[model samples]
Target chain A: MKTVKNESSKGSPRPAHVLQKSRLWLMYPPRLITTPVVWQLGQKHKVITNVRQASVTDEIGIVCLELEGRRADIKAAIRWMTNLGISVEPVEINIIES
Target chain B: MDKNTGFMKALKCRECGREYPLEATHVCEFDFGPLEVVYDYDRIKHSLTRAVIKSRPQSMWRYRELLPVAGEPTVGCQVGYTPLVKADRLAKRLGIRELWVKNDTVNYPTLSFKDRVVSVALSRARELGFSTVACASTGNLANSVAANAAAAGLKAYVFIPSDLEQGKVVNSLVYGAHVIGIRGHYDEVNRLCAEIAGKYGWAFVNVNMRPYYAEGSKSMGFEILEQLGWTVPQHTVVCMASGSLLTKIHKSYQEFMKLGIVAESRYKVHGAQATGCSPISTAQKAGLDFFKPVKPNTIAKSLAIGTPADGFYALKVMKETGGAAEDVTDDEVREGIKLLAETEGIFAETAGGVTVGVAKKLIASGHIPQDASAVLCITGNGLKTLDAIAGHVGQTREIKPSLREFEALLDKENKLINA
Candidate 1:
């Protein structure tokens, strides 16, 4: 619900939720598309539910996600991605826990 | 002159395939996906031919059938047909066979390849009933828009990052464009340009006028194939910032194949980027289905897009064509500039260096075959990005103009030359 700049067990990754939207800006020189990487990551994280991709431009692409898992596990999976040199940003959804 | 009607059907959404009237916008109203210029291959096949095209003047105009501009071109008609130099010496240094350089460094008027796109945009702007051409750019686009607009006798408005290189700023100012220096990164400046385009009727070339503008890039692919004995390359490497060039080249290859001109699509594309500004490449390597946004930090300022507009499509092409994207370091970029100059005698800017540097990396990693015919696109002239190599390009030897002064440094000079 709130952005806290903290990591998982290593105090490097903050909490990440399932069914929340996030983004990653990668620097891989071999490609400019993000779908392949997202598909590849979904294979690793058991909580991943769905991934949809949209083109940003000829030089950019965006991915929308619906993940289902523990917040810590999802955050750890995201940090694992960062360790791969693929930058990811977690965009929080406005929660109304009525 | 024959009628070239293949390019005027309508602009189609790359994602949804929804068509729109021939206009300047690059995105669709729904789903936020980008739009690309669509052509009727059946008409082009009937209209354009190699003998016919070869008979025409040597420029990007040779493929006029595929371009969006209507009627005779009036401004910067000397555009296109940049040289494709064989980099044998550079090839030997990199241990690759059959490497060529598609040099847009000497692009007319302004020194960058942006001239090619801007000329097309201006021509179509005139045809589409617009009198003003504008854009928000970091550097090259500003120069091209201003120069082409001035040549076309139209008013110009160019927006750029406030801290852009003086050389680029001066280049645009000299062309008499109404220059605006926004205090922000290229992304922020680009956002402002989008807002301005919505409010004002000014034809922002990269924003609203992109369909026609992007058609200009197809010439790069056309030239590469035509110059290479009417065959496509085994691999083509282009530096990626906004990812337009990479996708357009892919489209060009497709067009050629569809027209029965290329016979088949065998070209592999490699994208080059600075590590600090390599969002697409990072996504590609991380094996993601979509890109993660980046905060750019790189010496290849020409290609420092933190959020590339076509990054998604560029990635898609890489997958579809068995291509790869890679990033290089700032030091490697400088070395790449020196290497290209020393071996190929092509003193390209930082972005070109990124292509060369990343090409070397891809080659070493066995991504590109040793014997594959590869073309490294040098899109901009070194003069435009002078600041990138100002203190490092050529060695400055202080000496008097005399025989004794000449003889005084003979040993050092000889060793340097021979070494």
Candidate 2:
């Protein structure tokens, strides 16, 4: 997969003027627990995914994911997850992550 | 590293599989994930025995193996080891089988639980070669940072919201720390301080030094377990702000079990919040794993964190333990303060009032079992938030300066009481 850092189309427009990076804490409900949403997000979208922490149970799957990609792609990925009944929050996941 | 230091592994990211040197950094620079203080637990388990812990001074430092500092704590030497009073009177009032108050309102120096965290954060700040330290706080945290920083002789700057109670502001000013009162809420103040933390190299206890600062809260949990004859309580209710304390308390219990210091036992962890700014509790009640941030509007200023950073984790603990989270109204907060003071003689701040009020609600609703042993965490002194219960607690009766007048007043008071 090509790095999303330098995929701007020239003369059309740079969707994100600078590199867009975000860290999120996502909560996946029981029904969506079996789905490979995070794996699919990386393959289908122009994004890099890194999971910091996760605690999965039969009822819920909580994951802290860091997505580095174009702003538009990240938003779309979040929207897709939201549509799947996942809760995504833009948290300052690292400063005091413990 | 000295033998006194624990086997600290490295700063690891919770979101991304990344590792960094154990330094002053707190967040993952690669992906903005929070860094955690990882330890060589196998090594810690070998050295951190109950006997070794018992031999150390009766302070939070006794649990040094779990803490993140590299050397002996030089600051806030008198912090922690707070009295965990078995409140029979309060238990009778709540109609519970047993009750304990982890009374941090009398915590050393600033008289709040913030002393435990600040002590560790500043100790790490000094070790990391930072000569100045700062923090963005509501009230209690500022007082703690100001007082601890002054004692350590480190240059200190405390940023706080302008609307804090006058006592907290005065407490900080008296410590000779540079106090900056931003004319905004705590959330706004925190944002501005984050920007300032980036520009300046000073160690912000809850920002750059957060990973270490947060580890300090584990001591409160450790003390509870140790105070209860090295056994975990059936239920522990902690006041929530950023929600770090609740998570850390839970973590402390898990660590104790993991290290073989305590036997495997089921203990529930509950959280307390004021109705004005209870994002975590509101989410827990709604059966949601995520919380929507709200603008705080409660008298529990110390707990007026609209956007709790650890709300998700706190909810996870609550759900996993089959515990509960509840919030109390401002009126209930004052009543809680009065009930605790009148019943147990422990005058606590508004956050304490919130804890007591929520405990009462949980008990009445049968969420907290009728006979389960429980502990209510009281985090601050009531004198700091005197305004919350000013007119509500009633004024002192005026009496003539004479024995005859005093006798007459006593007789009148007795008649009124009987009536």
Candidate 3:
């Protein structure tokens, strides 16, 4: 399945870049709909796990996700989500350090 | 001096044992598995003793040797030490062998378990050099995040559904938090917070600081075992919203057993969810590996998170421990609350009612043994959700202070008594 792998839980960890980073987060405002908002970016990718929502707001809300999957789906999911009222954006979040 | 032992060791990832300098972070970078604060149990084993903790203070911090903070504690100093009331009557009513109520209803600052977590989140936010902290909450969490942030001298931004209980909204505002009501469900609101946290540096307690904040819930399990003479119960029935508390309590049990604080045993962990929002329980029943998030519609607003962060993990633990999950109706939730209050004098919020109602269901269905030792985790106070039981609690009996009035009332009482 096409998906958007969030560096955090949505998609595959960014191919160990020059920075050799471990985690990244995609954040949004509290909202009802999620995953779909970033559906295109993660179409082929699968979210290994997700942080889902940071807080809940109303009407037009936001959601943050950490996913994993193929690179193609991850890109498409983000593109598709923007059409669904989600302001698709990348986030640099650190959940833990071990 | 901060005791130099494993108790205050650096944080570690649960999915991967990557250790980081103690910072307020939650997710790991490698596989993105959630991180948790791991302790040095050896030091805790040697330092913390029943007698020593009992003599230190009547607070949650008394178990400092087992907690994961360095130096002096800066938050939740007045929390914990809640009632560990033996629920004999509740047991009798449910026909269970043993049931204990971890009555956090009287938790200080606010009467919910959120106080315990928010206290840690705000303090750790300050430690991480953040000037503001925020959260997207169902109701009780909003009340707590606002109050603790205010107390810790940090600007608090809280988001909640517009239709949240008035009591919860007022509670957040009264604490001087920047409370915003969204005109949608909690899941949507939470999505917004995640976005803002990325753009802004303000610490989102449950988002970035979730690892430590969640650790605060372990105190619930620790308190229960400590109150039970340092032994883990065979079965524990806990209320679920985000499923963090349930998973953490189980973590607490394993931690205690590993440290030789308690003997190892196969402890069953039962989860309770509101029928309006029972994704985890429903998934468990359907034997689905993943939880399908739902739009929550329940009077128990505290336990109303449609998409729980730890819902999957909660199911994993329940299955691994040979436990089960159940959901109760709104009517049963109220009855559960009233049943506990009337029978045990413990006024719990709607979540507690859900737990009591479900625990009874579990027993009736022969899921839990009739004579098993169990715990019903009452995570919040009922006063916060008074709207759920409006007009059902009691009615005022008006009477004039006259001898005739008294004589008539007395005659009615006597007649009823005789009849």
Best by TM-score: 2
lDDT of 1 by residue, B1-419 (tens): 22433346788887778888776566665543557777666777887888889899987888888888657776779997888999999898888988999999888878778888888888888877788877877678888888888888999988777886676789889988999888963433443455455446667677667778877888899999999888989999999987889988888888888887877857788889989889889998977656766777887888877667677788999998899889999888988888998997888889999999999999899899787779998888776676777776667688888888878799778999999
Q: Per-residue lDDT tens digits of candidate 3, residues B294-355?
A: 66789887777666667778999899998989999999999999999988999898999999
lDDT score, candidate 1, position A28: 36
Query: Which residue segments of model 2 deviate by more than 4 Å?
Result: A1-98, B1-5, B163-165, B184-188
lDDT of 1 at B357: 94
| Per-candidate chain B TM | 0.95, 0.96, 0.91
TM-score of each: 0.80, 0.82, 0.80
Worst 10 residues of 3 chain A by lDDT: A89-98
TM-score of chain A of each: 0.49, 0.74, 0.45
**Model 1 misplaced regions, further than 4 Å:** A1-98, B1-6, B185-187, B412-419
Model 2, span A24-56: residue lDDT tens: 778777888889989988887878888976878
Evaluated with lDDT, which candidate comes out highest? Answer: 2
Model 2 per-residue lDDT tens digits across residues B1-419 = 45434467888986685988887777787656678888888888888888998999999989988988987888998899999999999899998999999999899998889899999999989888888998876577888899999999999998867776676778889999998878863433544565466557788898878889889999999999999988999999998987889999999999999999988899899999999999899989989887766668999878876667778788999999888999999999999999889988999999999999999999999888988999998998998898889999887888778999999999999999999
Better of 1 and 2 by DockQ: 2
